[model samples]
Target: MQAAKKPVTFYLGEEVAMLKLQDLKAEAQSSWETLNLLDGTELTAEAFQVVMRKFGDLRHRSTWERICIQLEALWLLKGLENCDLIRTLAAPDTPIAQAYPAELLDAVLAHPSGLAQVKNGLQQLYSDPLTESDRICAMQFLKRISGYETIDLDLPEISLQAA
Candidate 1:
């Protein structure tokens, strides 16, 4: 039997408005600066070129369906199935990222490498002191990614205070 797709629910903060694509593009451009900084993918220069050629123009529209389709294509690319860069760009709670789709995010989390890459990328993005929008999106992304169970062990938190 065919499965039915559930409608996506967006969790927007009171102050966070869902801005239009032009605004999002401007926000992303100011925050990200370069596509290569999308360390989550670990995509080589050539692969990035391929992506640019394929989805570069189409992404301007930045609809949920379009993002999902692009992510599906990225999943097919050899050695890049776990690349969460594109999905990260669709971070939830931010109009800038278009709000990542749950189904696609689940598919990424299902794989071990995908989980790792996601964590790494999120950490890196969090570390960068970008725009306010970036910070909000990063936190939301972290919350969503942390819910999954992992074989990896938890490391002890480092504290500067006396033990």
Candidate 2:
């Protein structure tokens, strides 16, 4: 008689859950290429939304943010130029700010389309005369993404005469 087969075992431990989550994220990232290949025809807004929601749920926010930046870059390079899609992916109000990786943010800021979006978003944020805390956060965001460049502001100087 043949030896008894080993018993099959399955356990859903924390490590197992984390691994599953990573697999999901990887799948989501791979879907980008498929979506890009369709030339914006097959990847309907609803489908895209579902993918975004899945990415949003993953605890690894940085991975999702990097994927978004790469997707935006690919779209721009391929002449897709879909500002609405980029806007939706990089919306300031979304979890992007929390998940945004430094390298990805830098890459996005370097691209013309991404830079334009960032500038526009900053303008909108400052349009309402931001409070001190808000201003600090804006400054930090700019500095982090823009490589700590100095911005010049024009201010008039007053001259004093001695009697």
Candidate 3:
């Protein structure tokens, strides 16, 4: 017998507005500066799948998805992701690093190395005092890293079973 299903309620929150490529492109054109940051993912399925496996899912996160074209758009996201010498762009005091997505942030904060790297990668791109865009980007960076965290935890675990 087939299982019966209950009616589902979909949550149409803006947080998820940019999940699709169309939404990301549409949302990106809101502002000239942001529109300039929008990048088309002209990736083939095989190539995209490979990139998906090799890199973090920062472009697909909320707020960021609508603003920056994942890391592929603005250079800053990838800079922070590198965290080698780029994190210095962050405000000297960075509470904003804590704004990562739930799952990704949880994993990162739990790992000492990951925590340090994320803290290091954060930056301030707008102004010395940190403009509103800077603030927004800060949270977006955290969320971007959090997407990486989600990717880490999401890796398929392999197992063998006998029937």
* Models ranked on lDDT: 2, 1, 3
Best-fitting candidate, measured by TM-score? 2
Please give, for residues 19-127, the per-residue lDDT of candidate 2 as tens digits.
2345435545555656556665565567666667664553565556555656544543344333332333333332222233444456665676556555554554434
Q: Which should have the higher lDDT, number 2 or number 3?
A: 2
Question: 43, model 3: CA deviation in Å?
Answer: 22
Clashes of each: 1, 0, 4
The digit string of per-residue lDDT tens for model 3 on 14-131 reads 1221144554334333322332344544434464345434434535545444232332223333333434213322221221121222333444445444444444434322122245
What are the RMSDs of all candidates, in order? 12.2, 14.4, 15.5
In candidate 3, what residue range of length 10 has the lowest lDDT sum?
A: 91-100
- Give the runs in model 2 whose Cα sits over 4 Å from its true position: 1-27, 30-40, 43-69, 72-100, 129-134, 143-163
| Per-residue lDDT of model 1, residues 63-161, tens digit only | 433444334423422223222353343443334333445555665656555555665555544555356665455565555556643324332323333
Would you estimate the TM-scores of all the predictions?
Answer: 0.34, 0.36, 0.25
Q: Which residue pairs in candidate 2 have backbone atoms (N, alpha carbon, C) closer than 3 angstroms, thus clashing?
A: none
Error of 2 at 124 (Å): 1.9
The whole-model C-alpha lDDT of candidate 1 against the native structure comes to 0.45
TM-score of 1: 0.34
